[model samples]
Target chain A: MTTKTPEQINEDLLRPLEGTSPRYLAALTFFVLVVLAGAAAFLHQVYAGLGVTGLNRPVFWGFYITDFVFWIGLSHAGTLISAILRLSNATWRRPVTRCAEVITVFALSIGAMFPVVHLGRPWLAFWLFPYPSERGIWPNIRSPLLWDFFAINTYLLGSVTFLVLPILPDMALVRDRTTGWKKKLYHVLSLGWTGTPRQWSRLEMAMRIMAVAVIPVAVSVHSIVSWDFAMAPVPGWHSTIFAPYFVCGAIFSGIAALIIAMALLRKFLHLEDYLLRIHFENLGKLLLVMSLLWFYFVFAERLTTWYGNGSSEMAVFWPTQSGSYAPLFWAMVVCNFVIPFPILAIKKLRTIAGTVVASIGVVIGMWLERFLIIVPSLSHKYLPYSYGSYRPSFTEIIITVATFAGLAMLYMLFSKIIPIISVWELKAGEVTETATAPALARPEQVRAD
Target chain B: MASVNSIYGLFADPDAADRGVNALRHAGVAQDQIVVMSSEPHEGHAFSLLDHKTIMPWLAALGGVVGGACGFLLARYTQVAYPEPLITGGMPLVAPFPSAIVTYELTMMGAVITTVVTLLITARLLKWKQPLYDSEISYGKILVGVLGPSGAARTDLENRLRSAGAEKIKTTGQL
Candidate 1:
């Protein structure tokens, strides 16, 4: 570990915020264009109605729902992992926590957009909320979709707080360093932080509370998301095992996303020195564990279904195993398990680049997993004649691509606005290290006299 | 003792700041009157004035309870308010399971929001008027703020800070 002087740390952390390079502008323009294209496609879908996307009988939910589940699963990357690591007192998490938390906020925001997008009358999405209306009937409270609303909104609120709170001191730092409009903006964001003892105390206390509180919220969010499927009467969808299974998959996918994000940031932001090898190795180990756990869950879920021998469920299962969706299913297994296992498990190949490679596969695999899960079961619902395949239309593909571009663009924007690294937290880590080292060296130093 | 005076001493080294804070205390500066501001949080330092009491714990709990209550009301009222309450899947009118989901989410949301608000109020954030501050704090300097002692003690405080290796010391009128 490098011991950085406060001046060195300040300069390093604030480098990204100094000025936008030409490359940043170019990347931003590309993403913006992608976003615009996506918006146009979505508008086309709206103008043409839900028919633009392939929503035939028995397979109403398709790519949009898959994207919804994928992005929401990705949202688990930040708050839950960060909260867990923070509560556990992991020293290595200082450089990582903010990045992870940003993912949660943005992914949740993007994921929440889908339910509306998928709703045929998209503008009337507010009907989902419990409100007094001309229609005498309320939206069903017994529905898991309603549960999803409450859980996701709660998680988003917690995530926003979790992301913004630690940023105050750093905002104050920027407020002091800059002049003109940027300074004015930062001044308001910093909230008059004078760094008094009380400020630090309250900050630490709030962080601890958030760290503890957000974990359950994070867990509930994915569980509720899983319940969206499990609560249904459809064969493959209704199972008691779905909650933990989905939560595990969510974390599994979430960590892979975080790793990929960190690697990209390390390269583009030139944070190679700070976001070191150790961080990747540590995260790679985590990915490996999740991979193993994921393999186990997949095994358990599949084994139980195959053993039960229920023809209705078997119809849904066969497509994923050796039938129509078999290719995608096997690809998911390879990506989530096969590709990641050796690369992450073996220390030699678990370099930054190696982990990124594995993460790429995992991302693809997890997305395929969602696609397989939603499409196959929806296609093979009880009636044989109703059983039909679904394919994503051009509009759905365009919008899905746009969401990825949007995520990149948002992250770029956030990086420019603030120090993405938690500068104060890193310094705090250093301070604690130095502060505690002396006591360990000289036990008699504890004397009050 | 002519009048109460406020002073700031800047140090590049954290240990020097620590000693300076102790020196001010020995010179009869009350613990609450001595404020140490650093670019980072330095734990386990002998800076008693940095101690602060917070009501955030109570505030957050209160927020959670309120959120839980609101959640229950929203779920219940929506169900009952419907003039034509359609029974879906023959489930009861007010299902506790689904209501609990809303309640749990709202409870957590309330706690997080309340804690953040409490942090804002306690830290006195976003105020138009800036407080006494040093730009060097951002450049990794430790600043010791000595508030409201007489001129003689302020002079003694200045000497103490200077002797403890302060790079610069600035004295101002009473804050």
Candidate 2:
């Protein structure tokens, strides 16, 4: 096959989103309003101290911390799918990398803010930094909290770098295609790229380095986040398996978020041809593998705790399985483990609709999983007399809604600015095919003749 | 040293430059007598025809060891220097679990940073004075280089490249 003309490729890549449908616009407006409301509530919390939220003495971290973990966990999908897949040369990752990376950048920003939000004195949160303050004390490096500061910062920098590097070539393409301020913006961002052999080699090399580099950072970041809880002396929290458990769960929820993102972008951007059914099928396979792994971790964790039958561990386990939070606990198991196992297991049901449904279940189940991890331990501390149930207030709910809205808004804005799919990588793949196909086809031609 | 009798040079797209080197070997060029030079670093697989091997992975491994050591020091030495006099349940002041966290973080950070730095150094990047091939190669092309006898050998190499779908060919000075 002859190479498609640049004009045809440009048309294929930049087909304008069918002007935002009324329903879509209305939904977006509603989310924006909800986000504003949440922001207002957050402002109230900041002004009035965390006192405005339902977080009390025992339940110092409630929705905000859970959301923090959730958001950070969501960030893993991009690096995992994009960088990891790229290194392995998984061609299927081509369509999903941009959205995944964008989700990562946004999710990291959002997740990074929660620690600040959780701080009672938000203004004094700078105290976490290891600077010479009015107090002569440095942050205790021994503390997991301090480790979180390093881990999150490293993760954020790595994720941002990972996101921006690949986008440079795509930005150049966008600059070439568009006009007016967007073109100027793209031009300024594209760094005077002329597609020289040296530049391409360097670019590809940088991308390869980044892809290989980001995977471990991504894994370690979430593992450290899990350590924030697990390293605590609290009985239920002091499990060695927490690291892998958290990592698997992060990947699970991250993939689910990616699925939802792909579906939305596919619908909104009309990217069905580029992000085809096969991509979804591949993602479904990943989800199934992760689902089984997550289930295994969960089972191993429970069986160990149950077999040990330690009083404090059992105390936490009982509430999780059959006590006050049993409904949430069981629902988490069904959603995260049970539902995904079968739906993703069957090949016939691993289509777009099935994967999407399974993804939704995963998102819900993972959220519930966070809730299960958090509330149970806090509700069952060593001294039984001190343990108490946590109930989140309306303010907390509003802020949660706002944070999600903010994430969506950031994603929407990103799409409008840069392509949701990497135009350059797609083009590069196309060019590779064009370059190689003639050589590949000659044997066939000779055979045919 | 024997007077360098021949100034050998050839230009190619990166892929052709790569394949040309291998073809050079088949055409009776020795590993030491030939060099592949290009506008950028080509794949190591292409350099299999050469005498010197790439040193990137060795540097990466060294970085990993240093990083893991640093992590160990961070995890183990904290208690030693500060002396947390109070002990909890006789757990060693330097816990293995938390130490593993540090080890993992530092090891990965080291490996990644080293890999990046090695690539940059090997590719000879960020130098303002480096020469370049045509800009179009950046738009999805490759460049290959071979150094040997300039006249007949270069022509034969050019013919080989053209047959392999190389769009253009040129020769430069000694390197």
Scored by lDDT, the top model is 1
**For candidate 2, the TM-score of chain A alone relative to the native chain A:** 0.93
Q: Which stretches of candidate 1 lie over 4 Å from their true place?
A: A1-3, A133-137, A432-449, B1-5
Candidate 2: segments with Cα more than 4 A from true spot: A1-6, A16-30, A132-136, A431-449, B1-175
Q: What fraction of the correct interface contacts does each predicted structure contain?
A: 0.59, 0.07
Q: Give per-residue CA lDDT, model 1, range B5-122, as digits (tens).
A: 5787998877777777766766666666776787676666544235557788899999999999998888787777777766778887788899888888899998988999898887
lDDT of each: 0.86, 0.71
lDDT of 1 at A257: 95
Docking class of 1: medium
Residue lDDT tens for model 1, A35-60: 99999998888888999998888899
TM-score of each: 0.94, 0.77
